[model samples]
Target: MTDTDLEIFAVAPPGLEPALLPEFRALGYKDARYGAGGVTMMGGWADVWRLNLELRGATKVLARIGSFRAMSLAGLDHRADEFPWDETFYSGTTVRVEATCKRSKIYHAGAAIERVERALLKAGMKPSADGEVTLKVRIEQNIVTLSVDTSGESLHKRGHKEAVGKAPMRENLAALFLRQAGYDGAEPVLDPMCGSGTFVIEAAEIAEGLQAGRSRRFAFETLASFDAVDYKALRRAVSVVKGPARFFGSDRDAGTLKGAVANADRAGLSAICDFQCKPLSELKRPDGAAGLVIVNPPYGGRIGDKKQLYALYASLGTAMKTQFSGWRVAIVTSEPGLAQATGLPLSQGPAIPHGGMKVWLFQTPPLK
Candidate 1:
């Protein structure tokens, strides 16, 4: 494909296409289309780096190198060998090949992988049995598409949060929820049930102007044509400004509170965040100021029984109405009925698909 004709893939939370589309457009990507797991746009590799660094809701960014119709194993081998594998794969680097085939003559994924590997070997590039550079091959309806994973280890693992509580929200989902709640780092943000403080940490990072990818290396860095100096220059150009991040996360579980603190410290955000071990009954608004309150309460399967979780939701709702007047509230839950238990007038925000769970983001207007 030409440099201007790149196929860019951005993985988003399920059902968040409407919310995330504007974000892609804001980044200058056009012709955006929704796919099964995320969205596809036509852009170059530079857009991939910008998405990974700037897009808060994206789970991963991939560049589609090429696609062709492959009717049989021989066709797959021919197509694989025809690509410039030498330009993509380094001689000493180990490459991991992952393939998925559906309703195609090349149904045997193992055979397809073998042929692809053989072709790579013929190109004088050795594939390590255990390596970081991953090549993802997807075959469906006699069509095969080859893509190189630009973001390794999923962008959600932002290199913080060494310890996570049960049923912790991924960083990408947390950022999406924050965006849905109208969090722009200018207002005070609180996570009352902040297990491992994912929301608060993301908020702090945004408020502080931190680059999400600064702490980690991306797979694109290993590409043959990738310019390390240019990447560093681009990274340096992304300015980070420290701001008053009125971000707070409180959990009754002391262990989770500790985890949040540790994560914030590692992320260089401890000074900007306030972590506490406090119950919902004692939860107070930050300095009695109107801000955003986002909570991911205990779902039935994870920490509490169904009956107890219902009570938790009920109490959470009561507290929000009684104590958090004029504060916008966003609650994330797998159970829609539990949101009803909150007893607050909530408008359904979005039903985001996450990790095989269909989750609803419920929002309530600021209590008068």
Candidate 2:
């Protein structure tokens, strides 16, 4: 968190690393590349600020502040307490400490967390039993690396979209999925099972050339290293070019549709989004050019019968075949069997973690 350039990690949902790498490259991040858990690159405070602000696919952006070797609890305690806490955090700030131990002599993660918390307490910082800012420690082979959670509430919160429906796709993941479907600005987009209209709304934002962080706040804004003037300038630097595209979303639930409308309105995207209380079997061709049709249909865990989900998927596939030809398709489902029931000639990405379930993206070329 100094003026010197440092490492930045854009944490992606597991298995979506490939999907997120191009996004960082497009943003012009230096040495932008994907690793096991996320994308990593080097930057300064400004870059740290930008990633937390702009990245749509990152679940969190962690700034690797510093590291040390801690063979024992006492070693961890001494170095953690002596680390320059004042440089990054505001005085009297409350911080939560989280640690992970692997292949290390200090194998107890909870004990490691206690020692780090103790260090922070003695350094004039309060140990928040609950708070946003966190001091994350990773212990491996007796090496301890310390970093701060620059994204306070996880980037998916986005500050907008207040009314989230049951098992809604996170805005970050929605944005990345849209990108994976090869969605750019000009083409229209549709989400038939649009829970809270995340997919449609995110597509509209991208089409309108909006910054993902436009309506959000980041934890970096609360840090001592933050520069208000420079941040303001960066915010102002976003250029927008409104497109002629309209994004469409529909669901059977009236309450869900209403929530989607309100969420879109809050995000200033109601003008470019359409929401309706209509089931998939009743869907028709939207009044526009062919585009992408992305849906996160009921995975049947908490709603409806799993036995009937196959029939629902079959019906959806038939509906798409009859109504949405020439439009590509992307469906996210926890059940590969249910996805196969679609019979949509689909290809899948790696199963990704979502709401404690592993969901895969089943995609198809435009219908004949």
Candidate 3:
């Protein structure tokens, strides 16, 4: 495939593909479509870099290098050897090859990995356990699709949130949740039960028009198609958005609030982010244009007891109804009963797999 016409896939958290699709379309990828696990579109290497740098909801950006039909391991080896690996990787680059086989003659994943790694060795690229780049080989129905993980680390690691509380929300997932809650960075956001300030920081960054990957290094930087000058221009082209909206977060634990403050500072969003050490009972609506109250609270696990959490959710509901008139609310939890305790006019979104359990986003329209 030519560098200008590569298939780019942005991996999304399962069940949030709908929320992520619009973000791609919003960025001018009109043909971006939702697949089983993510979104896919055709773009050049520059588009790959831009997606990695700008899209906050994607977990990984993969470039489909090429695909070929191989009926057996020997044929796979032949095709792999003939494929132009030098076009993607520089000579002697360390890479990790992971293979998955389904409905194919080459059913053994280990054997397929061996063949691909052997081909890489012959191509002068070293296959190591701790490789900087990851090459994913998927063999399904005799079609071998070779894709490179252009995002070395998960996009969730925006590289600034160093301190996170127990079961803290992932940034990418938080961004998707915000979008699901109808947040567009035009209004203020408040996370009453914020831990390590993920939602608050993400909302602030969106409001300020900050690039998601501004502080992180990407695997694409090491690829042969990467142009440093073009990337720098892409980074510089993003203009910071100034708005009247502000983001706020509060937690009962002062220690957690400290970390949240530090996280916002590291993200260069301290000016727009405000963290307070307050209980759910004390969460008041900020004095200004009402926006969204997005929260991820405990669900009877290590965070709190199930029985007691009902009261907490009820308190949250009471606070929202009494003090936060005209603002929208979104709560994420694994239990429907907990959400019911809130007594808010809520609608449930798709079940999202988070922290080893299926959780959901429950949202309410602007309260009267």
Query: Judged by TM-score, which candidate is best?
Result: 3
Instruction: Return the top candidate by lDDT.
Output: 3
The candidate, 2 or 3, that scores higher on lDDT is 3
Q: How many backbone clashes does candidate 3 have?
A: 0
Range of the 10 consecutive residues with the lowest summed lDDT in candidate 2: 236-245
Global fold similarity of model 2 (TM-score): 0.94
Q: List the residue pairs that clash in candidate 1.
A: none
CA lDDT scores, all candidates in order = 0.81, 0.85, 0.91
* Residue lDDT tens for model 1, 1-368: 45668888888877775666666776667678776778888776666777777777777888887789999988887887887887766776677888999998889888888988888788877765676677888999999888888888788888766989888899888887888888877888899989898999998887776777777788887777577765666573434335454889999999989999999888888777899999988987778468889998877756578777888899999989888889999999888889999999998876666657778899988887
Taking all chains together, each candidate's TM-score versus the true structure is: 0.93, 0.94, 0.97
Model 3 lDDT tens row, 258-312: 9999998787777778889998877778889999999999998567889988888
| Per-residue error (Å), model 2, residue 17 | 0.8
